[model samples]
Target chain A: MEKGSRRSFLVFSINWATALIGGVLSLAAGIPLIGFAISPAFKKGESKWVDLGLADRLKNSRFKKVDYTFTAKDGWVKATKKRSVYVTDAGNGQWSVFSRTCSHLGCLVRWDDQKESFLCPCHGAVFDQNGIVVAGPPPRPLQKLQTKVEAGILYVKDF
Target chain B: MGFLNERLPLTEFSAHLRKPLPKHINLLFSLGSLAMFLLLLQAATGAFLALYYSPSPEHAHNAVTYISEEVPFGSFVRGLHHWGASAMVVIVFVHLLRVVIYSSYKAPRELTWIVGVLLLLVVLGFGFTGYLLPWDEKAYWATVVGVEIASTAPILGVFVAKVLRGGSEIGAVTLARFYAVHTIWLPWLAFGLVGVHLFFVRYYGSSGTPQNTPEEMKTGKPFYPDQVFEDVVGMLILFIVLAAVALFIPVPLEDVADPTNANYDPRPEWYFLFLFQLLKYFQGPLEIVGTFVIPTVGIVLLLFLPFLDKSERAVLWKRPVALTVTTVCVAGIVGLTLLGASSPKLETADATIVQEVPQPTEDIQKTATLDTETAEVEKEEEVFDFQLTEEEIEGTEEEEEVFDFQLTEEELQ
Candidate 1:
C-alpha cells in the first residue's frame, strides 16, 4: 500500500477494532443478563396438584360445582386461596373438570340451574354443559384443568 | 466481499457517515440522540425488571418488593429505568421544541415531524402503562382516573374505557393487559417509529442552526469525530446525572393498592399535569371539552404545524406568528403544570401546611439567650466530665461532642 493508503488503513483498523471489541464485550455481558432476567417468565409458578374430593361423587350427565382450597407459595409469602371448579360426568366413566375462570377474562363463571348454562357476571359470556362456548362474547370454550383420578379422588393442577 | 459491498451500497453508507455537519450544531441539537440513548437504557432495564415481575394482582406488589429488596442490584436497576423514563419524556419534548424553534419541520421533513409526534405518543403510552406495574396506590388510582377520562369521549366513551381497562374495573386482567402492552406492543411500535424518524433524518440531513450562512457549509466538519465527540460528551454527562439520582435518591414504591380507599388523591404524571389542571375549570357538562376537545385540537394543530408555517425563512425573528404561538403554548403548559403541582386536589384531606406563628421580639430574644446559655452549660459539663485517659478520650471525643450538641439543640428548640 502507498503511505497515504497505509495511514488510512491503520485508522480504519483502529475504528473497526474498537467497535468490534465493544460489540463482542457487550454481547458477552448482555446475553446472559437478559437470559437470567427473562428466565422467570418461562418458569412455572410454584404450585402442585391439589386433591379436590371424590370423583365418584360427581353426578352422571350433570354438573356438580366443587370448591377446593389450596395454599400457594409466592416468593416468600404463602397464601391459602379457595377456588371453585365445575365437574361434569361425561358417562362411560369419563369426566370433564373445568376451571370456573372464563376464557375471555379470568372472572368466575356461575352455573345457572335455571338456564342450564354457565354465565359470566363480568361480560355475560355463556358456556354450555360441556365447557364449550354456547353464546355471548367468549372467544373460546372455558378453560379445562388437568385432572387425574386416584382411588376415587379427583386431583387438579393449581397455579 | 467486494460483491457484497457493491450490493449493499457500502460507498454510499460511508459517504453518509463522512458527510459534514453544520459547525453550529450544538448540545441542544443532541437532544434527539440523547432521547434515543435513554430509550435504549429503559428497554434494557425494563427487560430485567420484567424478569421478576408478576403481572397478577395478588403477586404484583410482592414481586416488586422482592425485586427491590431481594434480587441483586435490583433496586438500582429499577431506579435507573424509572428515572430514565422521566428523562426520555423531557428530552423528547425539548427535541420537539428545538425542531419547532429552528423551523426544521418545514418541507422534506414533514413526515419526520409526524413520526416524531407518534413517537412522543408512544413514549407517553409507555409511561402510563408502566406506572401500573408496581401495583401501588398511586399507580392504581392514576390509571383509574386515566381510564375514566378516556370514557368521556361522547359516543365511544364506554367502549374505549372498557378496552383500555380490559373490563368494567381495573383488576388482574388490567394488570396482565397493561404488562403485555408495556413490555411488548409499545416497544415494537416505538422501534418502528424511531427507525422511520432516523431514516428521514439521515436522508434529509441535519437541519442546521437558524443563523447558518451558505458559506458556512464549506467550513463544516465530518460527523464521525466532530459531532460524535459532542454526542459522546453529552451522553456521558447525562449518564452521570442519571446514575447520581439513582444512587442517591432511588425511586420510591408506596403501599400496595387498596381499591376501597376513598380518601386517596390520584394525580397524573407531571407531563400530563397541564391537562389535569385544565380539567379543573370545567364541571360536569363541560368535562368533555376539557378531556377530549382541547387535547384533540392541540394534537391536530401540532400535527399540521409544519404545513401551516410554510415560511422559507429559518430565522426565528422573521416568523412572528409561529414564534409567538409556540412561546405562548410552551409558557402556558409550564405555568399550568406549576399550578397543578402546587394546588391540592378537591378531596385531599390534609393539603394545608400550617405555618408557625412568630412570637414578639422580646420573647424571641429571651429564647435565643436561653439557647445560648444551655449550649454554654453543656460545653462546660463536657470539658469538666472528661476523666478518661488520653487514648480513651481521643476515641470518644468526636462521638460525645456531636451527640451532646444534637441533644442540647433539640431540647432548646
Candidate 2:
C-alpha cells in the first residue's frame, strides 16, 4: 500500500480504538449509576425485622409509642436510623402494629384517643383501634408491620 | 507555470477554484453541526438508558426512578439524553431558517432542504415516542393527545394510531412499542437521512456569496481546514453548554401514573408546543384543513421546490419574491410560538366546570316540616297510659289464676 493510504488507515484505526475504549468504559460506569437511580423499588426488598423494644411496654387497651433503630445497606454503603410508631393490642391478646405512614398519602398518622382512632394530619383518613379503615379517602387499611416476639421483645419490619 | 503543471495524484481531489465559500460563517451556521453533535449524544445516552429501562407500565415508572436514584450518575446520563433531544430540535430549526434566509434551497440544493425537513419530523416523532416511555401522568396524556391527533387522519388514522400505540389502549404493549420506536426505529431512519443529507452537502459544497456578488468578489475559504476548525470549536462549545445544563438542572419528574385522574394538563414538550397551539387556531372544518391539509401541502411544496424554482440564481437580494415569502413564513412561526406560550391559559374544550345547584326554598320548608312532625309524633308516643282492670288485680291475688287462667277468663267474659 502507498504511504498516504497506510497513514490514513492508521489514523482511522486509532480513532476507532479510542472511541471503542471510551464507549466500553462509559457503559461499565453508567449501568450501575442507572441501576442506582432506580434503586428505590429494589430498596423495598431490603426492609427487615426491627426490634421496637419489650412487649411489656405496650399499654393495654391503647397504643404505646415506641422508637427503634435498624441498619440498611445499599451496595457498599450502610446506614443505621431511628424511626418511631404506635403499637396496640387488637383485643384478642394479639398485638397489632401499624406503620405511621398513611395509606392515602404518606403523612404520619397519630393516635387520637378522643376519636379512638389513628388520624392522618394531611388528610382526614381515620383508622379504627384495630387499624381497619373507618372513613375518608384512605382507600385501604393502614399497612401492618410484620412483627414477632423474640424472647418477649417486640420486633417489627422497619420499612 | 512549471509548479502548477507539476504532477498531482488522481486520488487527491482538487478544490474547485471556480467557486469559494463565504468567510463570515456566523453562529447561525454553527447550528447544523451543533444539531448533528446533539443527535449523536442523544443516541449514545438513549442507548445507555434503554439498557436499564423497563417497558412494562407496572415497572416503567419504578425503573425510571431506580435509574435516576440508584444508578451512579444515572440522573446525569438521563438528563443529557433529555436536554440533548431539545437542543437537537431547536438547533435544526434554527439551521433550516438560516438556509431559508440565504436562499440556500434554490436549484440543486433543494433535495438537501427536503431531507432536512424530514429530519425535523423524525425528531418530533422521537420526542413523541420518548415522552411516553416514562409512563408517568405527563407522559401518559401527552401520548394520549398524540394518539388522538394521529386518529384524526382520514382512512389511515385508526391504523396509524394502533400501530404507534401497539393496541387499542396504552399499556405494556404501548410502552414496548414506544420504546422500540424511540430507541430503534426512529433513530435508524434519522441516522440514514442525516447521512444522505451530509453526503449531498459535501457533494454540492457550501452555497457561497449571495446571488448578487460581483464576479470579481472573493468567495470564501475551503472546507477542509478552516470550516472544519470552526465546526470543531462550535461542537466543543456546544458540549460545554450541554454538560452545564445536564449537571445543574436534571430533568424534573412528575406525579406517577393514576389513570383514573383527568385533571392533568397534557401539553407537549416546549418545542412542539407551537404546533400543538397551532392546532387550536384551526377549529371545526378549518382544523382538518389547517392541521392535516395545510401542513401536507407545505411539505409537498417544499419537496417539489427544486423543480418549481429552476432558476440558477442563488442571490438572496435578487430573489425578492422568495425572500419575502421566507421572511413572512419565519415571522408567522415566531408569532405563532409567542401566541402559543401565552395562550396556555385558554380553557381546553374537554374541561368542564361543575356547579352545585342550590336547593329550592319550598323543598327546604317541606323538609323542615317533616322533621317537626316526626319530632311531635315521638313526643306523643313517650306519654303512654298504665292502668289495670279489676279482674286483672283479682287474678294476681289468686294462686288458682295460674293453674285455671282459661276458667278465670271465661268467668270474666
Candidate 3:
C-alpha cells in the first residue's frame, strides 16, 4: 500500500479520533473525581468577631493573652475551637492584637515577660513586643488580628 | 498441576525462580527482597490495626488507646507497624545505598533505578501518613508543622497545604482524608510501582556488583538454592529484629491530640529530624531556601542520578563526583539528625501563654482611667468596623452551605 493511501488516511483519522474521544471520556470522570477530592481545600474557615472582654483589662507594656472558644465549621463537622490572641492597649485608643499562631510552623507563641518578646517553644523562635521576628526560625511576624472597640469591650476578628 | 500450568504461567514462574544469579551477588543484594517482605508485613499488621482504628479526632486517640490497652495482641501488632515503619525506612535507604555503592543505576537499568527511587518515596509517604493515624500530640503537631511546611512553597504552596490539611485546619475530615490516602491511595501506588520496579529488575536482570567484570558477572548459580537461601535468611533476620523491638521496647501512645495545648513540644520522627534541624538554620525570609528550594534541588538531582552520572561506570570509587556527593549528603543527614535528637525537648513545655497577671491595684486603677478616656473618645470616632455586617455573615454561611455536602434538616426529614 502507498504511504498516504486514502484507506490509510481513514485508518489514521479513526485512530486519532478514537484517542481523542477516549481522552475526553476519561477526563469527564477524572475531573469530577479530582474536584471532589480537592473540594475541601476551598472550604473557608469561619469568620466572625469574638469579644475579648473589657478593653480596660488590656495592659499597655505587656500583652494580655486572651483565650476564647468559638464554633468553627470545617468540612462536615461543626466544632467549638479554643484559640488565643495577645492584646496590648497602647494608652490612647491604640490597640494591638496579635494572633498566637506562630509564623514558622503554626505552633502557639507565648509572651515572655522577661525577654519582652513572644517565644515559640517548638523551634526557639523569638518575636519582639511588636510581634517582629527577633531570633530562631520564625519566617514571618506573629499574625495580627483586626480589633475594634465599640462599648469599652474589645472585639477581635477571628477566622 | 499440568492443566493449571498450561492455563497459567506456572511453568514460567518456576523458570524465573530457577534463574541464574551473578557470582558476585552477596547479602547486600538480598536487601531488596527484605524490603519487599517488610512492606507486606506492614500491610498485614496495619490491616489488623485498622480493624479497631477510628479515623476521627474525637475517637482516633481513644481508639489507639483501646488497641494498646484492651485488644488482645493489639499493642504488639501496632508496635510491629510502628517500628516496622522505621525499619522500612532503614531497609529502603540501606538497599538504595547498596545500589549506589555498586553504581547499579547505570545505563539500561536507569528506569529501574528511577522506579526504585519512587518506591523509596512511597515508603516514606507510608511512614508520614501512617504515624498520624494514632492522632496523638506528637503526630498532630508534626502534621500541622508538615502541612505548614507545604504551605511555604511559592504560588501553589497554600493550595497544596490546603489540600493536605483538607480544610482550614486538620480535624476529623483531615484524619479521614489521611486515613483513606494512607491505607488505599499509597498502597495501590506502591503496589503498582513495585510491580513495575520488579518487572524492570527481572527484565534487565541484576546489574551485578560494581566490582565484577563481564566474564565474572556471567558466571552464576541458580537462584533457587544459594540466592534464595540468602534472601530468605535476610528476611528472617529482619523479622526477628522487628519482633524483638516490637516485643521488648513497645511503642507508647502519647496523650490524645490537644490542638489548644501550647505546653506540648512537638517533635518530628527520627527520619524527619534531619529536615527539621535543617529548617532551623534558614530562619525568617530565607525559610523558603531551606523548606522548598534546597530539598527540591536535592530530590531533582536524585531523580536524575542515572542521567547525571551516565558514564556506565558501575564501580563507585571511579565516579569521584557521585561518591563525594553521596558521602557528603549521608554525613550531612546523619549530623543533622543527631543534632535534632539531642536538642532540648522541654524548651517550650513551660512556655504556655503568659497569664495576664492582674496588675496591682494602683496599675489597675491607672489602666481603668486610661481605658475610660480612650473608650469615650473611641465611641465618637469610627469603630474599626471589625464586625461583619449581618448580611455578610449570612452570605459567608450561604457560600459554606453550598459546599456542605451534608443533607439539611428538611432533606434529612
Evaluated at residue B344, the lDDT of candidate 3 is 81
Identify the leading candidate in terms of DockQ.
3
RMSD of each: 23.1, 24.9, 9.8
> Model 1's CAPRI class?
incorrect
lDDT of 2 by residue, B1-413 (tens): 44654766422444542345565445566677778888999999988897899887767898899888899989989889888888887788888777766767876788888898899889988988988888888787677666756766778876666666654445565777688778888989999999999888777766644543544234566665666678889989888888899899978778775443323445567776666666655543454554468667877876776667765566555777777877777777778777766653312121222111111123332332345533332232223121223554565569665676465566878
What digit string (tens of lDDT, one per residue) describes model 1 on residues B1-413?
Answer: 79989689888878878889776676788898899999899999999898899998788999999988999998888889989999999999999998987888988789999999989889999999999989998788678767777877889876667667765557666787799989999999999899999999888878778677766653577887777888888999998999888888868788887653323455667887787677666543565777789888898888888888888847565789887898899999999999878765432221112111111123323332345433332232222211233545577787787777455666878
Q: Give the runs in model 1 whose Cα sits over 4 Å from its true position.
A: A1-159, B1-11, B214-219, B345-413
Q: In candidate 2, how many Å is residue B191 off?
A: 1.5
Residue A69 miss distance in model 2 (angstroms): 39
Residue pairs in candidate 1 whose N, alpha carbon or C atoms collide under 3 angstroms: none
CAPRI class assigned to model 3: acceptable
For each candidate in the order shown, give its overall lDDT on alpha carbons.
0.72, 0.65, 0.80
Candidate 3, residues B1-413, lDDT tens digits: the string is: 98898799998888887888677877788889889989899889988898999998878999999998899998899889999999999999999998998989988899999999999889988877877889998888889888898899999999998898888788877889899999999999998999999999888888888767777665788777778788888888888988999889979778988776757778889999998889889888898998899988988888899898877665677778888998899999999999999878544333434432221233333443456644443332222212343555677798997798988799999
lDDT of 1 at B63: 94
The per-prediction i-RMS, to one decimal, reads: 25.4, 25.1, 7.5
All candidates: TM-score: 0.61, 0.56, 0.86
List of clashing residue pairs for candidate 3: none
